[model samples]
Target chain A: MNYIEHTGKYFAMLKQIFRKPQKWIIFKESLFREMEDIGINSIGITAFISFFVGGVVVIQMALNLENPFIPRYLIGYATRMSLVLEFSPTLMSIILAGKVGSYITSSIGTMRVTEQIDALEVMGVNSLNYLVLPKIIASVVFYPLLVTLGIFLGIYGGMVAGVLTDLISMPDYITGLRTDLDPFHFTYSMIKTVVFAFVIATIPAYHGYYVHGGSLEVGRAGTKAVVWTSVVIIVLNYFLTQMLLS
Target chain B: MIEVKNIYKGFNGVEILKDVSAVFENGKTSLIIGQSGSGKTVFLKCLLGLFETEKGIISFDGRNYAELGIKVRRKLREEIGMVFQGSALYDSLTVEQNVMFPIKMFKNSSQKEMLIRVNEVLERVNLEKSNKKYPSELSGGMKKRVAIARAIVMNPKYLFCDEPNSGLDPQTSTLIDNLIHEITVENNITTIINSHDMNSVMEIGDKIILLKDGYKVWDGTKDEVFYTDNEAVTSFVYSSNLFKKVREVYTGNIKL
Candidate 1:
């Protein structure tokens, strides 16, 4: 489809998802389940990736700032900036775009091919509202929480990595973390996280909800969902950064 | 009664259903028998309002579906139930939960009331003991039974089944067919089944509509199927030697 067609369909799908659910109680129930699926279930991988990347960034900073005139605390400062300003919000989202995106696409695509969605529609249920709305709401609410947790873990990991490696003393790292800490940078990252979260939820859902074939097609849709979600997140990250931080 | 009048449906200008019409009666098992690409599914979907007909009217109980307001259309949908070919049971929900879904969505029943109704339907489908099992754990026949139970949980006025016995053995297929027929009669539902299964056609086909190449070639009862001379119906109904033999026995051409 061309850009206009795809955009129109996407917005149409968005409009459909906003329709009142068949049952509010059922919608609430699904919302909690999705929150668990998209948020709670994702903590382990997010924490692991965030901690390691945080440590790696600190190590890289230590190596690059080998000049005798440069202070050792700059390693901590650089690590803080990277994790809060970019890594926690953007990189973590790209990862989630892969993990959550595939799950949404395959699950909904499977439902489409298996005729479950048709069953819903035949029963007077708005299938899009019943299926996709919960996920979108869950992601929009919980993704920022996950990113916040990621930011904390990543900075702690940086502190641990720098102090253990003896490249920087604990007091010096703490001082660097406290010095010149702009609260706006944290807010800027949170804004990026919210936008990326919306993209991660909706784009994959769009792919999965409209997928028209069997298992092979569902698989292909999943791959396309992940790729598209990541690309959209990156592009949006650029625009959001420009608009919010520039 | 569900009355379809000259419905025309197509995709991208290529017609899949052309000027097809039929009346599916209440309290009877109506089967739409056709070959692959005979527009049986398309016709069924159109009847279910999953696909829109470009031209024609589908009226339920004398009310034109297309002309109904949005609220009325949805109310009409709530009165309808469907059993898909694949069973289409939610993979994540247990059998009991699956059966309870419609009730929970449409009715303001308490959990206890919902469970009671769910167990009642599960028992009706002979699946009372499998409440906690997931769809993945059920056999093909069991899955179809669960689908049936879920479909009838709402006690809907109209029931539509798309290839309900598609992947089951002969005995299981017979069981599913009998169960659907029994339910239709018990609830006085206007049941429409799309099938190419001759066993199903002979066993429970109270009224049969035969379609070929997007047209309704012939329609009649099971007894009439043995007597009809319509080539499209004959060629399809007697395609297999076993069915041909059965037809002969019915016609007394050869004694059993």
Candidate 2:
């Protein structure tokens, strides 16, 4: 489909997601299952990426500040800004768009291909509500916590870099973290994360749930899910930064 | 009973089911038999409400499906149990959980009651001890049995089986056919089976519709197959040499 048609269908799918579930208790069961699948299974990767990326940002900043007049404490300040303003929210969400995003698409796409959705439809089980709502709720609930963890690990990794490499001291890093803490920056980051969480859940679901054909289409759906989610995340990151941080 | 009148279904302006009408009565197996592209699946999907037809009146138990609201449609949905061609049991759930799924979704029964119902259907399908096993752990025939058990666990009044014997050996195919037939009779479900399996048709088809190129060309029982001169029905049923020999013997055209 063209861009307009795709956007229209995406909104249409979201509209159906809000329809009443076939049963709340059964939906509750799916919610917990998907919570574990999206949140618990994802923390390790989120943490690993957050820590390493934080260290890299510190190193990059130190290398760029060749001027002798610049203070070493600025490295920590920049790291804090980068983590809270960008890396922890935006980068972590992009990573999730690849990791959790592909998973949701592939699993749902496989179900669609195998006639499992058809089975649910015949049973009068509102397949969209049964499939997508739980994943959306799980991601919305837990992804911000993941981003919060990302923020913590990011700063901690920067501190480790500072202490080990002598670019800045732990005291200086701690001071920078506390010096210019704008509460709105954290709120803005969360607002972005919440939006990202919804994108991560629903975009992939749209690709997967509407997929036609067999296993090949399912695989294509997964690939397309990752691509579309990454694009949407990046585009939304830009717009959200403009709207909120400006 | 279900009555379909002048049903028309299409995709991208290409008609797949054209003016098809038939009556599927309770306590009998109604078979929709056609070639791969003859739109039997489309017709079945229309009956199941999975596909919306451009024009048709499908009356299930004297209520028009298209006229009903979502609430009433859902109420009717609880009475439908479908056995998919791929035996589409949830891969994540165990056999028992798969069987219990519909019961849990449609009824407000407690755990004890649901488990009892699950086990009862499993036993009816002769799959008592396989509850803990997953779909991947079951053989093809065993998977079909489990699908049947899952379909019937809710005691649905209308049962739909789509190509139930597609991937089974001949003996196992007969077993699946007989199991569905016996359950349909015992429970008095309005069973509609879409199959290419002529063996299933001859063995259990109480009423059958033959379709070709998006139109219903013939409708009758197994006994009528032996006497009918309709080329579409005969060519489809006697497409095999074995069936040809059996037909010749039955009609006294050749000595055995």
Candidate 3:
């Protein structure tokens, strides 16, 4: 399609989406499914990886401070900065691109190739509103929640390592976290996460909604949605942080 | 009733319909028949406003389709129902939900009323016990029936069927033809079907328009078609082996 044709379709989809936002039961269902599948269910894997990541960070810090020139409690400052600035938003987005992005792409692509979308058009139902809006809404609503949980668990992981490894006293670690953590960094992370969520949700939905061919094409679209969205999320995360914090 | 006047449509600089003008009357099954690539489907889509015609006017129920606003176009769509070449039922929805789709979109009926209407239409199409089944589970014929049930559930004033019997067995095709014809007559709907099937043409052809190379070559009733001297019509009518065998039988050239 040419630019004009593509723009026309885009506007038509937007108009349809806004026409009847209330009649979005299917979107709500898909959103709930995305949250459960992407956010809630992936918590275990996120926790495990974050625990090891924290352990690695603390061990490296302890070894570097072996000369006793640097304060041992500064490990908490380093952990807090890394988790708030990069790890939470970036890793959570990667996980969600795999989990929720794949689901949205596959489901919408199947609907497109199966003539279900055409059926909606013939019935005067807007396929975009029925298919894409829910995913967009779900991503915007749940991605921040996931990022928040990731940050908390990530910090807790570092605390467990610091206390169990006896590298730093428990009181020292607690006081370090309280003093080093900046509320502004947490806010910035959340803002970046929301932007990443928009990119992750919209890109996959766009690719899937326009998909043609049969099952093979749907599979290709699902893979493409995940790969492209993850790349965009990482690239955009850098720019968003620089723009917001610099 | 629907009227198409001097409509010209083309894709990629190749004309599919050139100056095509025809009238589809109410309470009759109007068929547009032609060989493959004869632009019957394109013309039907043009009539339905799915494609914009390059030139000319299409009026549905006396409203100029080209001049109507989006709201009016949507209102017109509400009174129109289409059964696509494929059954086009939503795979995720049950049979009952498929039939209830249009009603939900354009009607203000209560759940009780909607269910009653859905069951009535399903029973009308002889698909009573299959309400909860998905489209994947239904046979081809059953799926078509469900599509028909969905099309008519809203009591649309206009019905369009594109090759309604295309992929069915001969017996099932006849059954579908008879059902479409019966429904058209009973409801007084303006139905326009696009097909090249001679069986369907002869079975329910209240008004048949034959197209050849983007031009309407013949327009008449089924019985009237037998007496035409047009060579294209004669060749098409006699091309079937059954008609050829019947011709031989009448001429005493075969021992029947």
Model 3, global lDDT? 0.82
Chain A only: TM-score per candidate: 0.98, 0.97, 0.86
DockQ value of candidate 1: 0.87
Q: Each candidate: fraction of true contacts kept?
A: 0.89, 0.87, 0.34
Q: Alpha carbon lDDT of residue A140, candidate 2?
A: 93
Judge candidate 3 at residue A18 and give its lDDT. 51
- Model 2, A139: alpha-carbon shift in Å? 0.4
Estimate, for each residue in A1-246, the C-alpha lDDT of model 3 and write its tens digit: 785785587567556655564344545665786667656776777777767776677667766778677667777777777877888888778877887788788878888876667667666666677666666667778778877777777778888887888888777666667775568888899888888887777777877888889999999999988998898888888788789888
lDDT computed for candidate 2? 0.91
TM-score of chain A of 3: 0.86
As a whole number from 0 to 100, the lDDT of residue A221 in candidate 2 is 92
What lDDT tens digits, residue by residue, belong to model 1 across residues B145-197?
99999999999999999999999999999999999999999999999999999
DockQ ranking from best to worst?
1, 2, 3
> Per-residue CA lDDT of candidate 2, range B1-256, in tens?
9999999999998999999999999999989999999999999999999999899899998999999999899889989999999999899999999998988888899999999988888999899999999999999999999999988888899999999999899999999999999999999999999998888888999999999999999999988898899999889999999888888888889996
Minimum summed lDDT over a 10-residue window in model 2 chain A is located at A167-176
Which window of ten consecutive residues has the lowest lDDT sum in model 2 chain B? B243-252
Compute each candidate's TM-score over C-alphas.
0.98, 0.98, 0.86
